[model samples]
Target: MSAIQILDLSNNSLSGKIPTCMGSFSNLHVLDLQKNKLYGTIPGKFAKGSPLRTLNFNENELEGPIPRCLVNCTMLQVLDVGNNKVNDSFPCWLETLPELQVLVLHSNQFYSSVWVCSKTKHCFPKLKVFDLSNNRFGGPLPAWYFENLNAMKDVSEAGTELQYMGEGFHQDSITVTMKGFEFELVRIITAFTAIDFSNNYFYGEIPKVIGELDSLLYLNLSFNKVSSCIPSSLGNLSVLESLDLSSNKLVGKIPWQLTNLDFLGVLNLSENQLMGPIPRAPHFDTFGNTSYLGNLGLCRFPLSKECRSDETLQPPSKLEDDAKSSIGFGWKVVLIGYGCGMVFGLIMGYLVFSTGKPQWLIRIVEGEHRKKGRRPNKKRGGRRG
Candidate 1:
């Protein structure tokens, strides 16, 4: 009915195409048909000025491109069409929706690069959760889009009241891959933020701008063709919890700056061209050898590969070498002088004793006795008196 405001048929065995008329409702704020057997393209032609806020068609048998007509619903917030058969390019057009927050298009046939939309200055300004994994999206990481994720950069805590993300009537949720495990978050809080761009064809050096999102919680760029050294600027993410850059073409030593993230709990830099000793710290120490498994050049406690002494110790400078040589020569000279002194003393003693009381020794003793006789002991004189 047109009067219905919220329609939730998720996690059901409902089959057939989604009713086109449902998009016509003026008051419909939430439409959830996730985890269903629905088989058809999503209904296009959402009414202009429609108050629809949440549209979830995830894990369905849906096909065809995402309906562009739904852009008319200016008040839309959450759009999750993940784990479906939808085939389309990156939906850069959705940047028009100012109120859009969460966007999940993972496990879909979405292809092409997520190129910047020149028209929109502030794209997805309030987007907190962005999951585009398991798609055919290629090209370098979208630094343009990341630059405008103002919501993630600055999370507002204006109200003292705490609440999950959703219309008051229906609590919104989504499945996310975190720390190498799939987790179904039933209630997404306002502070929760994650960026999962893994399992894609994206290549090139990960943009350094990514470190600017200081408030980010989970970041996964794994299973891509991304190369280059991990940025040291990522240490700016003081509150970040999980970071996964595994199974990529990343090279160079793991940045020591990452050790500054005291809150980091999960770290996976495995299967890459990374070399050198892994950064050492109690936090990094907790991670097992598996974290640096595929990186043969990585060494330290987590890995059995010990760094060679030459690799760990620096070569001595010319000045240091000269100082060492001088010290060694000085010690050798002192030892030679000591040996000569000992030999001279021993030879003099043998000559004096072998003669069985030499005349020089007897004369010196007799002269000392005469001087002692002339100078009487003061204590002895006092006793006599």
Candidate 2:
């Protein structure tokens, strides 16, 4: 079909190699062949100037490196080739796709550092969602990796109207691990920005620049070798709902500023080097012990291990007592003021009335009689005869 614009044959039992002549479909804009028994490497027949926009070849027996010719499909927006045996390194060239938005390379043989760009100049400018979990990607977590996600760095994008991903008939889907659970998002939204690098060999500190992504809704970097203090800058994520940094070497006090995340509903910081008292009250009290487990240094609230008097510096219970004391002190001041005012009123009244006032009372009565005497008698109505 030369005029075929959308070709979707996913979730099927079909087996065999992909057609090498798919490039012949000059008008094809969407191609999906995921969740099948297909084998062999992807054909590098994507002709130059092809109008392809969405390409999906995930959940298959496909092997070998991704077709480098995909770069020719400059109009491509979504590329998902996860859950296959595709042995390859991170596609540093994909950064050139001006229209690319979503990239999923999870559960694959993709390895090595994804630090393609040294500067944040022109990499994944419009990308909203990225998933590289369960891969062989390793090395230090570079701060530039997050500094370049310009789409997520803006807080205003969250206010934009949400739009579903994918084109007509064929919907895009990605399986993401969030808050320690794998969730497959079938109908993704444009405002739904996430980063999943879990189950990797990444080490070193999670970049502080990561906290600059204020528009990010979900962030997962669990099961890695990340260490050092969890940056307090993460409190700036006003829209973040799910945050997973568990199973790392992170240490130091849980940043109290994290309690500023009013929208955070799912938090997993278990199995880290965290210490000191957990932040108290309001947002933090809601989380279960699963969030602070394995970190013996993390004490108080939800955890049965009580910290020393110095360790639990400002526990929630103490904060409550302070609030109550302040209220009581304010009430005491108000009562004292009221008593003083009442005594003053009594004294004023005593001074005004206790004075010899018999003359004043008589003058007031005389004035009323004088005014009455000055009035003319009123004639009865209807008495004219």
lDDT of 1 by residue, 236-315 (tens): 89889999999999998788778879999888899999987777767868888878879888776767778977566433
Stretches of model 2 off by over 4 angstroms after superposition? 116-120, 167-170, 315-385
For candidate 2, give the lDDT.
Answer: 0.85
Candidate 1 error regions (>4 Å): 158-161, 313-385
- What alpha-carbon RMSD in Å does predicted model 1 have with respect to the real structure? 12.3
**Number of clashes found in candidate 2:** 0
Note the clash tally of each candidate: 0, 0
- What are the Cα lDDT values of the candidates? 0.87, 0.85
